[model samples]
Target: MKNRSFALSTALVCALTLAGCGVLPGGSQKTTVDVWLMQGSVSGEFLERFTSEYEKEHPSVELEVTFQQWTGIGKKVMAALESDDAPEVIEVGNTQVARYAESDALRDLTLESVRDLGSEEWLPGLAEPGSINGSQYGIPWYAANRVVIYNKDLFAAAGITEPPKDRAEWLEISEKLDGNGRQGIYLSGQDWYTLAGFVWDEGGELAVERGGNWEGALHTEAALRGMAFYQELQSHGDGPKDADEVTPPQAEVFAKGDVGQIIAVPSAVPAIEKANPALKGKLGFFPVPGKTLEAPGAVFIGGSDLIVPEKADHRAAAVEVVTALASERWQTELALTMNYVPNKTTLAGVIEGNEGTAAMAAGAARGRATPNSPQWAAVEADNPIKPYMTAVLQGQDPARAARAASERITAALRP
Candidate 1:
């Protein structure tokens, strides 16, 4: 039988307040409202500045922020929710929000509240997954879509002019930019997020819904075609093969000023500048080209969402923070300061006029989210498809690997 004790006790939590309840870490401040965020997801300064800003603006209400590592965060959250001391607000990956949403562990956001929060401009692709059935469980904090960061100097030295205009040209440019001590590009081995773009470009989706259910679509002819092209790019590029290219990611190597191209998030810009200042004016960014020669191809949007846990003591303060964080000011500044796409498409105007940020904004305009399934976490958890995907990248048959991987994904998605 389901445990009814927690539910029974929560009924006594009417108009709950953080006053005289939870204490901040390292100090005994009773009114402090604790917030939890994923480490390395947002700039520490921006995160801290908001906390400072909120505390100063509303000095009576304290905001105590904490960050957690990406590893095992879901488990940590689940464990935290079972206790009475869970943080009031949590920022979790958009993909992981459904797990808690479906479990009734998150606060249900209403349309009225969504409007009041100025989230009407929120990215639908992202906001949808955070909503279950018909209610919103989490609000998109910010987002990052893959944009092609290239070494302009390399392109010029290789006699290549502008960024590739199409899929074929993209490959050709990479080939021309190769051999003189630098890789045309580095494709990280076993990185499904990057490869998934080609899947959408080839008219394939990671998964499709039919008859009120979802299923993997990797083995479809169109998807296989895309997967084949993904392998082709690796074989043609002059970089570490799938095995040697997995760790450190292509972004790290790209920052060293040797690799010609890499598909990465806007945050990589700061890293590249920090690593080699010489590459500052030399680096350029564009959305990954697609089969149709579109400037911004279908990119996988990556980022987290802000959620109020069901166990929050200071619901009013937590909801206020949620609304404040989801405010247009916070959301827009988030993208501008951190180089991520904001939660809304309307904010694309903010990042416009700059080549690099503009390209990312364009990519976000055409971005896609991961498949929304409660079991998707499990699928990503025990991804049996990675080995076969690596096999394909390392010269194994693409078709065979796609078929096998698709079958595995299908089985994994099933009840």
Candidate 2:
């Protein structure tokens, strides 16, 4: 009887050991979700902390995030999708989101999923680009718009009392501040985003839909007028002449107070403040002035977005990640950390904390999106507006340049 009892006890112990080693009927491990993000604007430390906190709350799920360069992320995502190994969640640029959505590469985020999410609780303009054919393909993470960043010290020295409020005044002010080893305005003539403002302000459409098809409108009379004004600024030495001399590659010029005013995005604000702390209180911001139009013009929506690929294995998990990122708390945190506009409506207070961000956000609220057609690449490539803009700035005829650019754009848009 003693031997039988000992053997029975040993058998029970063995069974318990096997169960601990996964021989049990209903024991499994937690699932993990993969997320991909761009590196520059988002901080790694913050992401790590956020991920850790999320995992603590969700014991069954683990999140793995990878960072990539801003320029090639789209291509990388496309390749990953082809291999059936795409990240469950991806952060993409606002401009690129349209192309992906148009290709049907993203999952359709129903209105129901986003309705109570309060994703639209932030600035309304930031949410505009994510809507394609009345469906949401991506959620805006953050956004930046154009603002006239001026050196107050320079403006005062030039005997200017206030920032210009209209196009005529802006041009007059530029002339007043020009010459004497200092430019009235410092702009990069080759920047498409910067140049695009003039076109939009002049009532030009970069691309327009007609007869159930998208067509290039970069060569319209409005565009010509816009391009002519841009050239005039460069010719008067109000800005830089070429792409290489633009703000990013050679910001030292602006830092040294060589340029009086510049149409700057919000991302450049931190750098300008950091580089010249003494000029902090002296810096000023306002909307980009219009040409013939009485009101301020539209500016490009510049920033990142969150997208889920159609080929992702964990579609539900990906949606959850996107929802979390698009949450009011997360969007506000991102705006405060990244200095860009938030997509959720409730986060406006965070951005409105500063006058500059507030003013820029207001301007962006009224801005228009870039063309959403897939052939945008071809249109941009064949467009001669950039070169013609250079010629116009160098004293070429506005009409001639406009005619030439219009012809090129028209040809490029032909199916």
Candidate 3:
């Protein structure tokens, strides 16, 4: 059963004071709202400033912020949600909402979204997953996506003056850049997120809902074509066929200066430059080219979303904190400070003159997320996509491997 015993009281308070203030007898007791933010989501300076400003603005409320690690966070979140004292607000991955909401432990934020926040202005990639069955469970926050980070010296050395506008041209140029002990791109075989974008570009979904049941669609013809394209692209690079990008740290690999290109968030530039300072001025960025020149390739929108746990001790205060973080004022601050794309497309101009973010923002327009199945997280927990990709790259029959993977996905999606 859902733990909604606190819903009525919390919702009532939020409705009365959407500004985050709480009314106590004599206004003596302060409401301490605990927020769990993913580590590295924001710098210490931003968090300190936000906390100070928020406390100053809402004298009756106290903000207690905690940073969490990404590793094993899924399990931690599930356990936290089941606990009686879960943090009021949590920063979850944008794609993780459906799985978390399946527990019915998250507060329904539809009313807050429509009334206090500009729901219509939120980015589809972040907003769509946050909404489940016509109700808002997650509040969209800042977003980031993959862009083509290339070594300009490599491009110039290969006689390529401009970034490719389409996949065909991209592949053609990539093949040209693949020689001379340098890889054209450092795309790992198990980088399923990149493969997902290709699947989306080819009009294939990772999974589809049918009559209230979800099933994997990786075996579809269009999806196979996407896989074929991924294989083609992988061939132009020397990345490990069995490992994902992070296995060897793609940024460190790129910093080695032998690779011409990599698909990564623009934030990777700093790490790349820090690893090899000589390449500082030689880096360039462009949106991941699509199949056609009309648009950029669809990328997996990577970002955080704010959610209020149902059993939070201070629910109303939590909603206020979420509202404040997702507000335009803080969104702008976050985008500028963290080099992220703002939650709303209308706010794209805030990142103007920032080339890396601009490329990411251009692709963000066509970004996609993982399948919205509640069981999708379970699928990722024991993912079949990575193995299927490895098998195909290792000369296994693509159809057979895809079928095996799809069947596993279907089983995982089953409750």
Q: Using lDDT as the measure, which candidate wins?
A: 3
Q: Write the per-residue lDDT of candidate 3 for residues 1-415, one digit (tens) a residue.
A: 1122212343355466653444544546678687788889998888878878988999988666667889989999999999998989999999999989999999999999999999998888899999999999999998999999999999999999999999999999889999889999999989999999999999998899999999999999989999999999999989999999999999999999999999999888999999999999999999999999999999899898999999999898899999999999999999999999999888999998899999999999888889888889889889999999999999999999998999999999998
Q: Rank the candidates by lDDT, best first.
A: 3, 1, 2
Q: Provide TM-scores for the models.
A: 0.83, 0.82, 0.90
Candidate 2 residues 61-165, lDDT tens each? Answer: 667676778676667767766667777888877767776776677888866346756654644455666778888787777778888888888888888998777
Instruction: Name the candidate, 1 or 2, with the larger lDDT value.
Output: 1
Model 2 root-mean-square deviation: 8.8
Top-scoring candidate (TM-score): 3
Using TM-score as the yardstick, the better of models 1 and 2 is 1
Per-residue lDDT over 1-415 for candidate 1, one digit per residue giving the tens place of the 0 to 100 score: 1112112122122225322344333444535577887777668778767777887787657666666888888888888877888889898888887788767878887763556866566776578778777788878888877778888888898888888878889888888877767888777666677778888878897777778577778878888887787777775455554443447656567877778888777667778888888888788888888787545567788778888888888876888888888787887778777777778888888877677777877777777777877778767867755676787767787777777887777777775
Model 2 stretches astray by more than 4 angstroms: 1-29, 112-114, 119-126, 231-250, 269-282, 290-296, 344-346, 380-383, 410-415
lDDT of 3 at 56: 93
Each candidate: what lDDT?
A: 0.75, 0.69, 0.90
* Error in Å for residue 267 of model 2: 3.1
> What CA RMSD would you report for each candidate?
6.6, 8.8, 6.0
Backbone clash pairs for candidate 3 read: none
Estimate the lDDT of model 3: 0.90
Worst window of 10 by summed lDDT in candidate 1: 1-10
lDDT for 50 in candidate 3 is 84
